[model samples]
Target chain A: MEMTVLIGLDAASYILTLLLVCIGLVIIFGMMNVVNLAHGEFFLLGAYTVVLLQQYALPFAVILLIAFVVVALVGLVIEELVIRRIYHRFLDTILATWGISLALKQLVIVLFGPGSQQAVAPFAEPVAMFGITYSSYRLFVMGMAILITAATFFILFRTRVGLTARGVIANRQMAACLGVNTRRVDRLTFAFGSGLAGLAGAIMAPLMSVDPQMGVGFLVPAFLSVLVGGTASPLGALWGAGIIGGSNSVVAAIWTPVVAQIAVFSIAIVVIRLWPGGVTGKRKR
Target chain B: MSGYSRQLTVLFWAALIASPLFLDGWNLGLLSQLMIYGIFALSLAFIWGQGGLLCFGQSLFFGLGAYAMALTTKDMIPGIPATTLTGLGLAVILPAVVAGLLGLALFKGRGLYGAYFGIVTLSAAVIAERLAINWSYIGGFNGLLDIPPLRVGWGSWQTELYDPLPFFFVVLVAALGIYLLLLRLERSAFGTVLRGIRDNETRATFLGFETAEYKAAAFAVSGAIAGLAGALFAVQFAFVSPAILGFALATEVLIWVAIGGKTVLLAAFIGAVAVKSVENVLSDTLGQYWLLVLGLLFVVAVVLMPRGLLAPFLQLPLPRALRLSGSKEE
Candidate 1:
C-alpha cells in the first residue's frame, strides 16, 4: 500500500512538472503560431533569478514572483523585437528562435563562468503520506501545480482577454474583424506563456543544479509532451503531460532513469507514427 | 548551368587548388576539415534546398558513419577486415541503410512534412545521443579514441596518410568528385522530379510519380554522402563522441547551410568553410561571448535574408530544361 502511494505521488509530481514546463510552449505554439525554440532559455532565466537572489534574504515566494516577472518582460522584449517580424514564416521563426537559444546559453556561460549554482528548497521537512515519509517541498510543488492549472483554466475560459486570445488563435482575421486588438493579444499571450515557463524553472531550481545546459535536459521531454498533447488544444496539454509524465515516472520506478528516457522517446515516436494528430487529434487553424 | 555560374565554379575550384601553395600546414589541415564539413553541408543542401525535406537531425547519419569507421578500423566488428577501404565502405552503407529505413517509416503512409518532419528527426537525434551515452561497449560518454588514419594499397605496399598534405589532397578529390556528381544530378530528370515534389507534393502525386520512393531515395543518397564526410572526419580528428550525434552539431550544420544559401550547392559548401573558419578566429578573441554575436547574426540572417546572405552572389541559374521554378512536364 505504501509502495502504491509512493508511486502515485511520484507520478503526480512528474505529471505536474511536465505540465508546468510545457504549458507555456503549448500556448506560444498554439496561439501565436510561433515555435519559440528558446522556451528553454526562458526557463533558464527563471532559474537564474533564484541563483542570483541567493545573496538576498528573501522568501522563496518573493523570489519566484520576481523571476516570473523578469522572464515575462524578457519574453515581451524578444516577441516585440524578433518574433513580431516573422509571425507566419514558420521555418524562419524556428531558425531565429534557435539562434536566440544558443545566444542565451552562451550569455549565461559568459556571466556565470560555466559553473552551476545551487539553491535550498524552501520546505525541507519530511511529511508523512500514507505512512511513508516524503519531501514536503515536493508535495508543496504538486499542490502549487494544481493551483496553477486551475488558475490557468479559469483565466482561459472565464475572462474577456482569454476569449479574445482564443478568438485570435482560432481565426486571426475574424478576430480582428471583431475588434479584438490581435496584436496586443498576441503580445500578452506570449508574455504569459513565457512567465509560466519561468515559474516552472524557479520551482525546479532547488531540485537541480542550475547551469547553462540545464534547459536542454528539460526541453526534450517538454517538447515531447507538447507534440503528444496536440498543440492546438489547451486540454490536450493535460492529457499529453499525464500520459508521458506518468509513463516516465512508472518506468523510472521499475528501471534506470536513462532507460526510462529512452522508453519515453520511443513511445513518443510510435505515437507520432500511429496518431499523427497527437492524442487529441485536434488541428490548429 | 549558366555561363556566369560555370565561371564561378571554375574560379572556386581554382582557388581551392591554389590555396595549399600559400597556406601553412596548420591552416591547410583546418581547410581539409572544412572541406569534409562542406561535404556534410552539401548533403543537407541537396535534401533541404532542392528536395524540400528539412532534416533537423542530419548529424545522426554523420555520427553513425564516424562510429562505423572507428569500429571497423579498430577491428572491433567480428569477421570484417579492418582495412581503410572496408571502413569507408561500411560508413557509407550503414548510414544509407539507416536513412532508407527511417525515410520509409517517416514518408510511407501519411507522411510527416515540414516542421513535423524536422521535429521528429530532432527527436531521433536526441535519442541516438542518449543511447550512445549509455551504451558502454562502444566507449559510452567518453566515446572511441585513436581511430587509425586512412591507408592506401595492401599489406607491405600500404601507404598511410600521416601528413596533412596527403589527406588534404584526398579530401579535395572527394569533395570535387561529390560536387560534380551532385551537379550532374541537379540537371538530371530525377532532380527535376524531386524539386516538383518539394514545391507541391500533392501535385507531384497527381502526376503519377511515386513521391515517397523518390523522397526516400533522396534521403538515402544524402545520408550516404554525409556518412562519407563523417568517415573522413573521424580519420582526420581520430576521435568520435556522442556530441557529434546530438542537437548542437545538428543546429550548427543547419546554420552553416542556411548562411551559405541552401539553394546553391557551392554556396553551402563555402558557407561551411567560412562559418567554421570564422568560428576558429572569433571564438579565440571573444571567448564564450562569440556565441552571442553568432546567435545575433543567425537571427538577423533568418529574419532578414531567408534566401541566405551569400546565395544571390553564388547560386547558378539552372538550364531552362532543369529550372525548378518553371515546372513544365518534360
Candidate 2:
C-alpha cells in the first residue's frame, strides 16, 4: 500500500514539475509562433538567481519573486533587442534564439565557474501519508506547480492582458485594428513566458543539481511537450504535459530511469509520426 | 561558373594542395581536422542549401559514422572485419539509410513546417545521445577509445598513416573528391529539380515530381557525406564519444554553415575551416568568453544577413555545362 501511494505521488510530482517547466513554453510558442530556443537558458537564469542570492539568507519566497522579476526583465530586454525584429521570420528566430542560448550558458559558466551548485530545500521535513513518508519540499513543489499553473490559466483566460494576448494570438492584424497594441502584447507575452520559465527554475533548483548545463537536460522534454501540444491553446500544453509526463513517470516505475526516458522519447516520436500537428491538432481559430 | 568564381575556386584548391609543402607536422594535423570539419559542413550545405531543409540533428549522422567506424575497426561486430575500408563503407551506408528512412517519415503528407522539423530532429539527436550513454555495450557514457589509425593495402602489405603529412594528403583527396562529386550533383538536372522543390514544393509536385523522394534522396546523400567526415575524424582523433553525435555538435555545425554561406559548397567549406581556425586563436586570448562573441556574431548574421557573411561574395553563377539551359532561376 505504501509503495503504491509513493508511486502515485511520484508520478503526480513528475507531471507537476513537467507542467511548471513547460507552461511558459506553451504561452510563447502557442501564442506568438516564436520558438524561443533560449527558454532553457532563461530557466537556468532563475536557478542561478536562487543560488547566488541565497547567501544573503533571504527568505525563499522573496528570492523566488526576485528570480521571476529579474528573468522577466531580462526577457523584456531580449525581446526589444532581438526577438522583436525577427518575429515574422520563423527560421531566423530559431537560429537567433539558439545563439542567445549559447551566450547565456557561457555567461553562466563564466560567472559561476564550471562546478555544480546546490540549493537548500526550504521545507526539509518529511510528511507522512498512508503510512509512507515523503519530503515536504516535494509536496511544496506539487502545490506550487498547481498554484502557478492555475494562476497562469486565470491570467491567460480571465484577465484583460490575457484577453488582449489571446486576441493577438488569434489574429495579430485583427487585434491591431481593434486598437490593441499588438507589439506590447507580444512583448509582455514573451516576458511572461520567460518569467514563468524562471519561476520553474527557482522552484526546481532545490530538487536537483544546478549547473550551467542543467537547462539542456530539461530543454528537450519541455520542447517535446510543447511540440506535442501544438500552438493552438493553453489546454494543448496541459494535455501534452499530462500525457508525456504521465507516461514517463509510469515507465520509470517499471524500468530503469534511462529506459523510461527512452520510452518517453520513442512514444513522442511515434505520436508525432501519427499526428504531425500534435495531440491537440491545429487551433480552431 | 562565372570567370571570377572559377578563378577563386582554382586559387582556393591550389592553396590547400600546396599547404602541406610549407606547414609542419602540427599545422598539417590541424589542417587535416579542418578538412574533416569542412566535409561535415558540406553535408549540411547540401541538405540546407539544396534541399531547403534545416536539419538540427545533423550530428546524429556524423556521430553514427564515428561510432560505426570505431566499432568496426575495433572488431566489435561479430562477422565484419575490422578493416579501415569496411569501417568507411559502413560509416557512409548506415547514416544514409537512417536519414533516408527518417526523411521519408518526416517529409510525407503536408510535411512538418521548417521549425517543427528542426525541433523533431533536435529531439532525435538528444534521444540518440541518451541511449548512447545508457547502453554499456558501446562504452556507455565514456564512449569508445583506442580506435586504430587508417591503413591502406591488402592483408600483409598494409601501411598505417601515422605521420601528419600522409594523413593530410589522404584527407585532402577525400575532401576534394566529395566536393567535386557534390558539385557535379549540384549542377545536374536532379539538382535543379531539388532546388525547384526547395523554392516551392507544391509547385514542383504539381509539375509531376516526387518531392518526398527527392528530399529523402538529398537527406541520404548528406548523411552519407557527414558519415564520411565522422569516420575520418574518428581515425584522426582516435576516439568516438556521444557528445560528437548529439545536440552540441549539431548546433556547432549549424553555426559554421550559417557563418560560411550554406548556398555555395565552397563557402561552407571555408566557413568551417575559418571558424575553427579563429576559435583556436580566440579561445586562447578571450578564454571561454569567446563563445559569447561567436553567439553575438551568429545572432547578428541570422537576423541581418541570412545569406551568410561569405555567401554573397562566393555565390557565382553556374558553369555553362552545369546550368540547366534556359532556366534562369537561381
Candidate 3:
C-alpha cells in the first residue's frame, strides 16, 4: 500500500513538472509561430541563477523571481535582435535559435567550467503525506508547478495580455490595424514564455546538480510533451505532459531510466506517426 | 554556365588530382577525410536543397552507415561476409532502408513539415544515440574499434590500402562520382519536380504529383550517400562510436551546409571542407572557445548569408535545357 502511494505521488510530481516545462514551449510555439530551440538554455539560465543565489542565502521566492526576470529579459533581447528579423522564415528561425542554444551552453561552460554545481534546497526535509513520508522538496516542487500553471492560466485568460493575444491570434492584421502593438505582443509573449521556462529550472534545480548540459536533458522531454499534446492550448500541454510523464515515471519505476527514456521516445514517435494531430486531436494548421 | 566557372571547375579538379605531388602523406590523409565529410554534406544539400526537408537528424543515417561498415567488416553479424566490399554495400543499403521506412512514417497523411519535422528528426537522433550507448552488443559507450581498412581484389590477391596515396585517389574518385551523379539529377526532369515540391508542396500536390513519394525517394538517396560517406569515415578512422550519430555531429553537418549554401551542391561540399580545415587550424590555438566561435559564426552565417557564405561565388548557371524560369517549366 505504501509503495503504491509513493509511486502515485512520484508519478503526479513528474507529470506536474513536465507540465511546467512544457507550458512555455506550447505558448511560444502556439502564439507566435517561432520555434525557439534555445528554450532549453532559458531553463539552464534559471537553474544557474539558483546556484548563484546560493552564496547569498536569499529566500527561495526571490531566487525564483530573479531567475524569471533575468531569463525573461534575455529572451526579450534575443527576440528583438535575432528572432524579430526572421519572422515566418521557419528554417532560419530554427537555425538561429539552435545557434543561440549552442552559444549559450558553451558560454556557461566557459564561465562555470565543465563541472556540475550543487544548490541547497530550502525545504530539504521529510513530510508526511497520505500516511507516507515523502521528500518535502518534491512536494514543494509539485505545489510550485501547480501554482505556476494556475498563475499562467489566470494570466492568459483574465489579464489584458491574454485579451491582446486572442485578438492578435484571431487576426494579426486586424489587431495591428486596431492600434494593437502586435510586435510588442510578440515580444512579451516570448519573454513571458521564456520566463516560465526559467522558473521551471529554478524550481527544479535542487533536485539535480545544475550543469551546462542540463538543458539538453530536459529539452527533449519538453519537446515531446509539446509535440504529443499539440501546441494548441495549455490544457493540451498538461494532457501531453501527463501522458508522457506518467508513462515515463511508471516505466522508470519498473525498468531502468535508460529503458524508460528509450520507451518514452519510441512511444512519442509512434504516437506522432499514428495520430498526426497529437493526443489533443487538434489538427496542425 | 559562365565561361569563368567552367574554367574554374576544370582548374579545381586538376588541382585536386595533382594534390598528391605537393602534399605529404599526413596532409593527404587529412584532406581525404575532409572530402568524405564533403560527401556527407552533399547528402544534406540534396535533401534540404531539393526536397525542402531540413533533416536535423541526418547524422542518424551517417552513424548507421558507419556501424554497418564496422559490424560487417568485424564479422560481428553472423552469416554476413567480412569484406570491405560487403561492408560498403551494407553501409549504403542499411541507411537507405531505414530512411525509406522513416519517410513512410513522417511523410504520410498530414505529414510533419518545417519545425515539426526538424524537431522530430532531432528527437529520433537523440533516441538512437541513447540506444547506441546502452546496447552492449555494439560495444556500448566504449564503441567498436580496430576495423579493417579497405581491401581490393577477389580472394588471395587483395591489397590493403594502409598507405594514404591510394586512399586519397579513391576518396577523390568517390566524391567526384557522387558530385556528378547529383549534378546530373539536378539537371534532369526529376530535379525539376523536386525543386517544385520544395518551393511549394501544396501546389505540387494540386498538380497531381505524389510529393510524399518524391520526398521519400530523395531521403533514401540522400541516406545512401551519407551512408557511403560514413563507410569511408569508419574505414579511415578505424573506429565507431555513438557520438558519430548524435546531436553534436548533426549540428556540425548543418553548420557545414548552412555555411556552404544549401541550394548549390558544390558550395555545400566546400562548406564542409572549409569548416573542417578551419577547425583543424583553430582548435589548437582557441582550445575550448572554438565552439563559442563556431556557434557565433553559424548565427552570423544564418542571419547575414542564409544562402551560404560560398553560394554567391559558386552559383553556376543551370544547363539551358533545364532552365525553367523563362516562360517554361521552372
Best by DockQ: 3
Candidate 1 residue pairs that clash: none
lDDT of 1 by residue, A202-231 (tens): 988888899988898888788778778877
Report iRMS values in order: 1.8, 2.0, 1.3
**Model 1 RMSD, rounded to 1 decimal:** 2.2
TM-score of each: 0.96, 0.96, 0.97
Judged by lDDT, which candidate is best? 2
Chain A: TM-score in each candidate? Answer: 0.96, 0.97, 0.96
* Local accuracy of candidate 3 as per-residue lDDT tens digits, B147-266: 899998887788999999999999999999999999888878788899999999999999989888889988999999999999999999999999998998998899999988898898
Is candidate 1 or 2 superior in DockQ? 1
Give the per-residue lDDT digits (tens) of candidate 3, residues A47-123: 99999988998888999999999999999998887888887687888898888998988998998898999988987
- TM-score, candidate number 2: 0.96
Can you give the lDDT of residue B50 in candidate 2? 89
Q: Give per-residue lDDT, candidate 2, residue B51.
A: 86
Which whole-number lDDT from 0 to 100 does residue A183 have in model 1? 87
C-alpha lDDT (0 to 100) for residue B111 of candidate 2: 68
Please list the C-alpha lDDT of all candidates, in the order they appear.
0.88, 0.90, 0.89
Superior by lDDT: candidate 2 or candidate 3: 2
